[model samples]
Target: MELFQNVVKLRGFLGRNADVPPSDGITEDAYTILHLATMSGTWDIATNDWKPRIDWHRIICPGPWFCGFTRGMRRGEYLEIEGELRDFEQDRTVVVVGKRYPAKHLSYTVHATRIQQLERPLLVVDTGDDG
Candidate 1:
């Protein structure tokens, strides 16, 4: 089976290099949606074992968290997002009410639990006891 290597913390720019859009994508199950393309590098710098690319993610923000993000997140701001990374296998065989089509691609997304900007976090998870 799988062992370890599932979480990631990235510091980068948005796909638009400014404003980030709302979370949007096809749901992975009943509770997750892949959203946003987080650009990790300027593409001008290349190193061995470094792949030139942009990382698309599904930063999980359940309920009010998401609403708050779109409202507070501004343009052209560099930030850090930390979360769990997972690869999901999707069946793209059906399109438009039962049309069958085959697709080839591996999907990897991040479920961000927190974001930081200039030593300040937008949201913090408080672990508490039920007692």
Candidate 2:
């Protein structure tokens, strides 16, 4: 539990520095993808003492749209994606399917998942309404 907590703190710090410049030879697009995969959501956990394990519904990329890239790729293109999550701190690793330029081919199915610690309060439980 303590190790997970430390990992969460580290993730938070890294997320805060998400806008920092990237290393040499790394394109802006690559950096953006990395950032999106790692730090795309708010961190909120149900309890501070324990980090919850989360199983996210597979995120399906519609058509040519990359996860965070506004410019769509096309309708049979496949991309390699890997992800990890601890509590609510989640990160995804994506790889372009082929060496094709402009990646026009679409994928039949593409999904990505990640784990991260959330920093928001959960919604209140719903109560039955009395008419």
Candidate 3:
């Protein structure tokens, strides 16, 4: 078995239709981008009410295979995705008043290994107990 693992599984809905940007002449650069959203609820003791939270995720699939399939997917379409979390670093140079400055930005994205569309979502039950 492996000693280290970086796996992420997310079940959520599509925020919008999938997009495939123009390839940058690199074979491995061909990929699709998907916006996914998930929800979580918690009972607030102080407010004595339930609070809902929504989390958005950026998903990247490395291939042109899923383009057609995901292109037709509409917003709020339920999906289950399995992948690993990846971090990307981007560098840029800026020029201001004849001076040059370098900048670096870091971003996190989920690299999907598998994706499936679920016809129906599991039911969520609300228990009155604050426990």
Candidate 1 stretches greater than 4 Å from native: 1-5, 17-58, 93-100, 119-131
The C-alpha RMSD of each candidate to the native structure, in angstroms, is 14.1, 18.7, 5.1
In terms of lDDT, model 3 sits at: 0.85
User: Candidates ranked by TM-score, best first?
Assistant: 3, 1, 2
lDDT string, candidate 2, 18-97, tens digits: 22222443443432222222224334665534344422222232222233342232211222343432233234444578
TM-score of 3: 0.74
Model 3 Cα displacement at 39 (Å)?
A: 0.9
Ranking by lDDT: 3, 1, 2
What candidate 2 gets wrong by more than 4 Å, as runs, is 1-57, 60-70, 85-131
By lDDT, who's the top model here?
3
Per residue, candidate 3 scores C-alpha lDDT tens digits across 1-131 of: 99999999999999998776544532545778899999999999999988999999999988666654565677878999999999999998888999999999898999999999998667888876898
Residue-pair clash count for candidate 1: 1
Cα lDDT for residue 109, model 1?
A: 70
TM-score for each predicted model, relative to the true structure = 0.47, 0.17, 0.74
C-alpha lDDT of residue 105 in model 1: 58
Displacement of residue 56 (Cα, Å) in model 1 is 4.1
| Candidate 1 TM-score to native | 0.47
